[model samples]
Target: MAAKSSQTMTIPTDAELVQAQADLWRHSLSYLTPMALSCAIQLGIPTAIHRFGGAASLPDLVTTLSLPPSKAPFLSRLLRLLSTTGVLASNEAGIYSLVPLSYLLVDGVRIDGDASQTALVLAVTSWHYMEAAMGLADWFKKDIAQPVPSPFEEVHGAALFEESMAVLDPECDKLFNEALAAHDHMGIGTVLRECHALFSGLQSLTDCCGGDGTTARSIVKAYPHIKCNVLDLPKVVDKNPSDGLVNYVTGDMFHSIPPAQAVMLKLVLHFWSDEDCINILAQCKKAIPCREAGGKVIIIDIVVDSSSGQMFETQLLMDVAMMVYTRGRQRDENEWSSIFAKAGFSDYKIVKKLGARGVIEVYP
Candidate 1:
């Protein structure tokens, strides 16, 4: 046993307490940083800079981005903050250049006036989605067990899916659907390149809730021998053209999934609760064959882990999105295991090829 001392604890000085308060206040204002990025994206700053041979002076940017003379000073300040925060790079002469981070915001080579899919995702997150997060504390004060829907429902008066289906906001629906397609363009392409072996043996695959058939199209293009089908809601499938490359089926994944050799649920599981996810997985199991027949559910979503720095931060941020917009979550390995076990999956394998995300294969 150690002897106890009568020493008094040191008290913080007034200056120390004031400095701590300042630090807290600084963190509180950090939202302005992302808001600045959103503003830049809205103003087409990234594309402007890229068009200027990857570097542009403030005046050149103001002209290229078509900012009015009145907003030039404010735009300068925004760029300075973005550069200082390492979202972009600035040279000694105050010329701005695109960094790897800002490059994702650039319009794709096939630009049609919309923001890049990645940029659209960022913009949407900062808009109504973030407004929902702002109400989280107040939402938590309610009796959560009473089917609160989500924090999004607390603010918007409806769940996100319901609102999207209702077409209450046409602009929001367009943005959300386009963002999903863009995300699939970037993420699914990377997954296919990294894990081509996963799709090798499957003769037929169904991309459940696959919007616009981007994933199915990509898969069919890469492996023409394997037939791919996209199953989504009637309204969503109705908009997709009969491209002849892939078949589009109108249905709900909760009730049933069209029969296929394998079921591919890209970015779907994270948008539902445990019970809903289990139900959906059971449907997937029913749609596919036994493990010996090469049937499995392929999931592309974030797996929360603390081992990586940026990836862990990304997963935490996405978890907050799920909390705010839906009754879902970014699950850790154990949470995923529980869901898979509950869904009657005998085994699962996680392919950590996608940065900040993973490909999970669940076998029935």
Candidate 2:
């Protein structure tokens, strides 16, 4: 009787078998989500629906997108998939409408030029990124002692920051830059508005590794009295000439940062390893004044926390993306504290949470 009971327990129940199959299918087919999203964005489906008063029927989308009558069925299937994925909404009457997510994809919806997330989506879904993602499994199988820094480097034969993409495809480089600038604009705008106290008395600030002076220009716009200097590579600063408001300085962050009351490293440190981050922070410490003089380093990056539901999930996704593209990983609070202490920072404070990221103020 005991043996028979054990055998019965070993056999999977009907419900357990069905659930296991469902879980396997869901995980296997997860790649289709991004592919479908990319296709919808490329086809300008969001813009088309927006043009039709943010709600459109099947025939309306066909006419607006200039699809042939024969392709109407396929378009319907695409819309149905998008709706199921929560990218859009559909009613029993077959009318489709834009949800919050689709609004960012509509052309001209953002007042700030090129500040929408559309370019970012396109850049991430581009061929190079997809190629790198496909190579991640094989990259894991390689010897750990191998010098292949990341899956992207393994696939592309060069690091992401080595200007390999720019050399190989100028258009991709431009798109990626645009995406970064857009994200900077959105993030900095929020920080300035919500955390005004952080920059209240700053007289001079340096934007370390600032790309094309986007963050500097925004800071100058918000606080005209603060003298903003952007430090970056010659290739970046040369193209973006000083607008006479923000000073553009051509230099490397690893060696030195221009003197300032405060130094800002927005989305810069995460691309490097922990040791490299410490070195960069040391440079930042050298650039600022004593803590008593309101000198600090402002960092805007992800602070991974499991308590935050969707934001935590997004952070994890970005952490893996970093693993694939760079040698960096998003740090939790304890990890960040360890790095700060090692870098000779006297103290640090997480001022606020900005979506999936956070504002960290490190004092000398």
Candidate 3:
């Protein structure tokens, strides 16, 4: 029998121990960053600074926001944190200013008049999401055979998309749609610029699970010759009136999709499990023609790559967010390829990598 070797454990030096403590503390309190940002948004701090010609002193903000004088010190602390986190900029004079990050949070200032991330921030930092994130520890303690699939379901008693938010909370429903539209607007520019060739010769296209026809409208505007359709559930389609540009079809992608020369699934598959993704892609396959006929499914989603530095970290963060919110996860190249192959796709091509997400062309 081989003798087991005993490994000696070296105690961390004082400096190393102190550094480790700081790192641990940073990770432990990292949730405060988003919480502070959310609080700032709720208080209209970004807009207030924008109103002050892009700069506002502490007194200027308090006066403009009509905040009580007693809370000025507390507000100052919040601003300090926000400035430290790069959400806003602060000068030595203690005047707060909008940085590029905070500029997007200001109302009515859209990137190319398309969308602002204000809605996305609001939706993500809402109570329900925060509660689910808080419940993650307890969720992990559950047995493998437990009925609950996610922290969100554990808290809310149902999957997020199992029923329309319109039925559950009308305000949240509106905010959620706006959030998706905002996100799609931010990414659509990259897709159109980088993957223009994918849509050039297509006669018709379908945007599966498209929310509010945001991406569809952008596509139609870019390629006017191609007819565009937005496929979604009735709950989502009914609220969005036709603008005479893109046709909105009430349908489910898992069951069937309207036939098109090409199809696009923008940020949709990440919300489903692999089996569900395969089912959805198979339906997409049935909707489009063979690959030789210029038929393909364009997917704009996060393709996790560990070597991509900050982008990889963002992907991992979103992966955990998915774990808390749904049964889905962000996939790497191999995982994505496996799903595509299982869905009967013969081949696929990654057209471009747009920051944390990628534009993929999956062939039938």
Candidate 4:
């Protein structure tokens, strides 16, 4: 059963409506799935299972993860949810196997011959490590879904980009970058695998609001013929080496974007309000040529309802995450179309749907 059954089973049978509502209250209060997965990853459950000869039973899983007898059943419940959520899977024989998503976190999972442990990077999804403020009031009550400024900004008056540059904690910065890189590993890698056709015929592309150029590097690697530039604030470029496959340009997307055949904005617009998005899109408009000249904005981000096949529930949870983290919110097709119209775009097409994000081609 989809974990989403937890989200949609609002009304219950005729006899137990009161009991059902009481049960719903408790189930709705549980937000520990991601946290538990993080704990399992941090404790190296997959690694332990692998070393223990793969596909272990519940007791074996408990032993591998080092749980007490009292907590064994709790661990089993955790595993059950993790399995349902696509992180792990269970068998008829009662053994568990890491799914593709979890195996991707196995230490030394490689790409392009580079082997690095997924240790620190897995923190990206750790609810404790990546906490957003309380958006519950607005989220449960209001229809608007825009995220606030990132949690760091909510507390420290600075965004992650700014903090990465100004903060003196090099170790924290490195770990943070690793987390971003891991996310890029999934996000960038997913798009390249499922939607490479969108990059065809593009000779030049710039990643607006690109931090550290991980996505740009992925794009350039997939389409080596195309020249890619990552445009961000001056501080991010000052700290990062420009020697990668992607050229690094120091600039703000709202002020101006370097000229390119196309502008790629991934996980950016949701950071701003409608007015802010308009400013950024206007700058993107000034950067690219006409659609006939291959001028377009290639956006890889969640378009809320674009692909509701089985991910609608995950998408809704992600929408709440945005509420905690930024003033940005994921938009449905209508919301996107409205933004495109306001930005003076002629037409747009939602391309391939992959995982949580959908590839969108916006014409200038």
Candidate 5:
């Protein structure tokens, strides 16, 4: 009877222990944390407190957010998690104060054109990211098990570029464009400071995939001679400029890009698979003059394994993001070189050690 009980035991044996250890990944899946965070931002919890004259007590927060009396304990638990993340601060008496990150939640914080929060909201719940999250486990596997069976293919049943057109609801487009520009602003600031030489001898530059002209405007401000143009979809330019400096041109980069001494393609190529990148690059090659005329493509993107420093986990997170959103894959130096060659480019130089990104000068 004792032996039979031992044989039927529910507790793990040594092999089962190893299997359970491997399966512990289910606990490690913490994306729900950020999803919850996004929900808070969407609910304008921080903005409500700001309107309430800042520093909110627990009871005050409950009232402001209008929680039911029955869920009071659960609401406190949520607040505790937000506090632990430094998104919201707690006073000595346990009243919560808004932090810098929370300030992003306030709609009218930027008198000019601060679009950071809008982008954040779009990025978190975007279909691209949702599809990628659906394929997260497939990223770990060595082989794709089916025809056109990439993790992205599995989720979207199509390529990234296809979905870009499919995701054409007006509200979503606004959020996505806002996020794109806000993200570019951060990347361009770092690129301008670190890779200034890449811009040398270029009389004008066009940000081909630049949404709403954030990076181009910054460039035109910094270098008065370097006239900048922002080329994007018709919808992107539809809203008349509120406060951007560079002129906006509605066009497609795949067929034609505006003429420039050098074209800046930041965070664009990674959205396309290599074939599509080649198509875009071939157009870029046509848009500019030869290298002697300072004709080149200034690419600010990740060359994933370039012997650089610590990558923000966001970088790797985005690689999987590309896999789901488009057929694109983030490349290392070798992979980038291959794409350049495929695009009929001669040579390229990479300069790393920038802020969480790499700057590459690709010559045609």
Candidate 6:
């Protein structure tokens, strides 16, 4: 026999092994939870509960939902899963109630008309989104030194925006726009509410890559004295009606931006690489007055905070989401500083009160 081996493998204890396996299984099956939520949305569970005085027993939910008798037990199981997952509330007597989170799924409920379809679309698990997610493994295996497109591009053979505009799926496009509107509403709401001081002195502002004038309209609505302009591609601008409160101008942001005292790029930089962002910022710099004339770039995006546990996790999740969808990322303050420096911005300030995101004022 060979020389006696001194090394021995340390095996996990039975309980440890069992717990590990359970955790793995739980993670593996976690996809089912979102799928179940999607199914519930499809079955009008949120609407049913809302219509039933915000809480309904199984039989009452079945009646309100118009479900067949045979599916009651199965629906009950689904509800139990949703309740356990905190999507809804369930009492000891088997009644289901809508939570603030679940209430987002009810259409026509939002007065501001900024309610999101993302929750519903994500729950239904859009094929394009799912395909990109499934491609993550192959994406990781690619050479780290080599250039790469986003996982979404690797799957669909085009960037997310390019694919969305080129594709012929009307329903998908509508849902996507609604989802975008919802997200924009939330982010812009935060900026306009918490960062009003940033926009107060500026007379004219341009929203580069602004979609349907959502951000611009919100800004003008709050501060009517500030003239707002939105610059986007021709296709996006052609679809929306001209709101008297905001001007929608059609153009490519890479080549040019509308001249303004301040340029607001709300959630725009996160979709591009640093190089691309530098190019865009260069164009933005040219479009605005000098720093003494109240010229600056207002960026509303995630500034990753690693100090907080849950916020850090959410920021990382957004980073992965950006990886799957685009060549961008959720930047930390240092990364943002680096990008700003490269883009010829002399100084910047950050206001981090907007939940997981911040308003970064970049001066030229």
Candidate 4, residues 327-364: lDDT per residue as tens digits?
A: 66777889888998899999999998777778899998
Q: lDDT by residue for model 5 over 111-150, one digit each (tens)?
A: 2356347466647576655765767677656465533345
lDDT of each: 0.82, 0.88, 0.88, 0.73, 0.73, 0.82
Give me the overall lDDT of model 6.
0.82
User: Which candidate tops TM-score?
Assistant: 2
TM-scores for every predicted model: 0.89, 0.92, 0.91, 0.79, 0.72, 0.89
Lowest-lDDT window of 10 residues in candidate 4? Answer: 112-121
TM-score of 6: 0.89
Candidate 3 lDDT, 1-364, residue by residue in tens: 6554554557789999999999999999998898899889889999999989999999999999999999999999999999999999999999999998898898888664565688888888888788888899998887866334889878876566556456667777678768877776786866788777989999999999888887788888889998998999997899999899999999878789999998899888998888889999999999999999988999989999999998899999999988998888999999999999999999999999988998899999
Go through the candidates in order and give the C-alpha RMSD of each one to the true structure: 3.9, 3.5, 2.7, 6.4, 6.7, 3.5
Looking at model 2, residue 48 earns an lDDT score of 93
Model 3 CA lDDT for position 261: 90
Per-residue C-alpha lDDT of model 2 across residues 188-290, encoded as one tens digit per residue: 8778889998888999999999888877887888899999999999987899965898999999889989999999998988888999999999999999999
| Over 4 Å off, model 2 | 1-12, 111-113, 144-148
lDDT: worst 10-residue window of model 5 = 156-165
Stretches of candidate 3 exceeding 4 Å from the true structure? 1-9, 144-148, 164-174
Give the TM-score (vs. native) of candidate 1: 0.89
- What stretches of model 1 exceed 4 Å from their correct place? 1-19, 68-73, 110-115, 118-127, 144-146, 163-168
> Residue-wise lDDT of candidate 1 within 283-328, one digit each (tens)?
9999999999999999988889888787898799889877887888
